[model samples]
Target: MGLLDSWTAGSHTADGLTYPTYRKGSGPGVIVIHEIPGITPGVIGFAEQVVARGFTVVLPSLFGRPEGPASAGEALRSIARICVSQEFSLFALGRTTGCAPWLRSLARRLHDELGGPGVGALGMCFTGGFALAMLADAPIAAPVLAQPASPAPLGRARAADLGLGPADLASVKAKVAAGCQVLGLRYDRDPAVGTRFDTLRRELGDGFVAVEFPGRKHSTLTEHPQPEGVERVLAFLEEKLTTKPET
Candidate 1:
């Protein structure tokens, strides 16, 4: 059976873009954007954990085959497709991915239906910075970046880019100033993450809670699977989305 066999499958369309989504559980909503090579077993396993933690989780298949295995071959093929896709801003510095609007729309829809403080949005690996971008427009009270690798991190400039444009960055700053906390998890030596964490620290200051593990591992909540990182994410989501804010 497929890894997603038990989850309810659906599709979301926004800004003239459509993508399939797998959903499960019941409670406050949390959007789990899959890593490269799609929703592999590892990704599914993590999502299941979130669901078990009492979240209505939605897994968006941004790229790669859903339920596909996480092999190097699959990763390469997905990377090739992502590089050519107009939806992602892979090499562009200081620009949000074209798919951000669609994701924002999905978050809004989930929040509107659930009617909580707001929904949680967690993006992993290549899509990691997306959760931050969504905060510019969506009611994403909880934004988690798990090993965000974008803009390719090729040069010094790209390495420090937050994968957000000027306007989006300004909006995110405003949100942070208003008390929205962003949770970021990564290995201390993960080259794929580049210096985006440093950028986030500079930009968000104490608002960005960074949880760094010690190692060269990537994919904090997935393939590499750091238990502490996963628990930190769940706690952050619960605090931001379900807990009432002080008046």
Candidate 2:
């Protein structure tokens, strides 16, 4: 159903977990993390975009099993549907809510099994800062965060997200101190990812770099003129995890 007419999408299982995913393209590995909309048409388009850039892009379906992006206004309604359908258990909610530990394992397996030194991550919107959390593990060599929603959920969402909750903040600071670099982008107008969120970079000392788009909104990277943004994302990764050109 995507431009990659020969789309080979299915479920990938590792460590006893089965995750629905789409895989294609060639080069170093790059995992594409979808925003609140789930893997909607736009995100699949982004996956195709990344594939065009010469990287093996994998978009996993983590919307509590049966997941796909819905209408903007119906996101909450969709959440309710996923909650009830997933059996609504506390532990299940914690595991399915955040894309951290599982994604970490997937990246590691890709590096160890798929034969890449490591993998690059592109996380956006609600998942903006997720790439940073993925970096907590060394297998993620390059992390790209776009329009990261700041940690201030009107409830439990904040606790589930990676917004530096003291202990976790301390751990990330340690990774940055050990020479990890994270690149993040945001539109100046979106209130979810505000100036205060920039403190995460400040907290990281020199390892964090944030670039701002003066007028672009939260979903700015939905398409081009955003091509350059996507290119920069790959370039940043190559800078960190580049392999020698073949002889």
Candidate 3:
């Protein structure tokens, strides 16, 4: 059977952009934005964990072939496609990815469909910072960034960049100040993550919950599969989406 054979397939469109989505489970919503090379087995496995936890999960196939292998060639191809696509902001400093609006729309739709505290959004690898960006405008109570690598992290400026524009950053700060918290996981030596964790700490203050592991590997919640990191993520989602917030 295919890796995603059990998931319900659908499509979501916003601002003239459309992408295929796979969904499963039922309860509070969690949008799992796949990393580079598309929805591979690892990504699917992580999504299944979320589904098994009694939360609805949506996996968006941004680029690359679904159920495709995460081989070097496939990664290169996906990188090339994203580098040229107008939907991504790979090299720009302090700019939110062009796909944020569509993702935010999806989050809004999910939250509306299943009313509650709010939905959780997790982004991995190249799309990791997307959850933070979506929190600025969407009903994303729980935002998780798993090894966010963006703007190529080529220079010092790009390295510290949070992959968010000025206005969105301000909005996120406000939300965090009010009560929202962002969860970030990354390897301490992962060069692709750059200095954004520092930036998040500086910007979000006590609101950014950072879980760092050792070594230089990336893809904390998937490729590397850090057990502690996975447990922390699941806990964070439950706290923010399932439990009622104190007023």
Candidate 4:
């Protein structure tokens, strides 16, 4: 059977952009942005675990083949396609990717339907930093950046930039100041992540919670889903998304 075997499939359109989405489970909404090269088997596995944890998980098919397995050739092909796609920011520095707006809209809509303090969003690899950008608009209560590798991590400027334009950066900073916290996880030796985590610390200060593992692993929840990293992510989600008892 395929990775997305029993999941319900559909498409979400916002701000003139549409992409396929798979959903499962129940409770608060959590949008799982798949890594580049598409929704691979490992990503599907992680999504399933999220579902098992009681949250309604929505796996967005942003790039690559949604049913593709995680293979080197598939990853390279997807990388080539995304590098040329207008939806991503493969080279631009300090500019949010074009796909961010669509994602933000989707998050708002999901939060509205789900009806909670807000919704959760977890982005991996090229899409990792997207959750931070999504925070500019409200309703993203839980934002996780797992190994954000965008703008190709080619230089210092691109390496540290979260791809947020000036205005969006200001908005995100405001949210952080207002007490919104973001979770980040990455391998200590992953070059693709650049120094973005350092940038997060410098900019967000205590608002950023970073969990670093000691290794060269790149895909935190997919290619190599570390037990500790997964536990941290799940606990973060529960803390942020779970409702508190009335006094």
Query: In the order shown, what is each candidate's alpha-carbon RMSD?
Result: 1.5, 4.4, 1.5, 1.1
Give the clashing residue pairs of candidate 2, or none.
none
Worst 10 residues of 4 by lDDT: 82-91
Off by over 4 Å in 1: 243-247
lDDT (Cα, tens digit) per residue for candidate 4, span 1-247: 8778799999999878999999999999999998978898888888888888989999889878888878889989988888788888677888888988899888988898898879999999888988987888758999999999986788789888887888888998889999989999999999999999999999899999999999998998888889899989888888999898899
Alpha carbon lDDT of residue 170, candidate 1?
Answer: 98
The per-residue C-alpha lDDT of model 2 at residue 147 equals: 79
Q: How many clashes show up per model?
A: 0, 0, 0, 0
Query: Sort by TM-score, best first: what order?
Result: 3, 1, 4, 2
| Model 4 residue 162 CA deviation in Å | 1.1
Candidate 2 local lDDT, 1-247, one digit each (tens): 5343455677766545677877887888888887765776677777777777778888876662223444755556545654574321222211222446677877886677556557888787766766776777538878888877635344555434454345555766787787877787767676666553456555766688766777746664663236667667767867766587689
Poorest lDDT segment (10 consecutive residues) of candidate 3 = 237-246
Each model's TM-score, in the order given? 0.97, 0.79, 0.98, 0.97
Tell me how far candidate 4 lies from the true structure as C-alpha RMSD in angstroms: 1.1
Cα displacement (angstroms), candidate 2, residue 214, comes to 1.3
Residues 1-247 of candidate 3 have per-residue lDDT tens digits of: 9989999999999999999999999989999999988998999999999999889999988899999988899999998999899999688988898999999999999999998899999998889999988999999999999999987899999998989999999999999999999999999999999999999999999999999999999988888899999999999988888966589
User: What are the lDDT figures for the candidates, one per model?
Assistant: 0.92, 0.65, 0.93, 0.88
Ranking by lDDT: 3, 1, 4, 2
The alpha-carbon deviation from the true structure for residue 67 of candidate 1, after best TM-score superposition, in angstroms, is 0.9
Residue 92 of candidate 1: its Cα lDDT? 94
Candidate 2: worst 10 consecutive residues by lDDT? 87-96
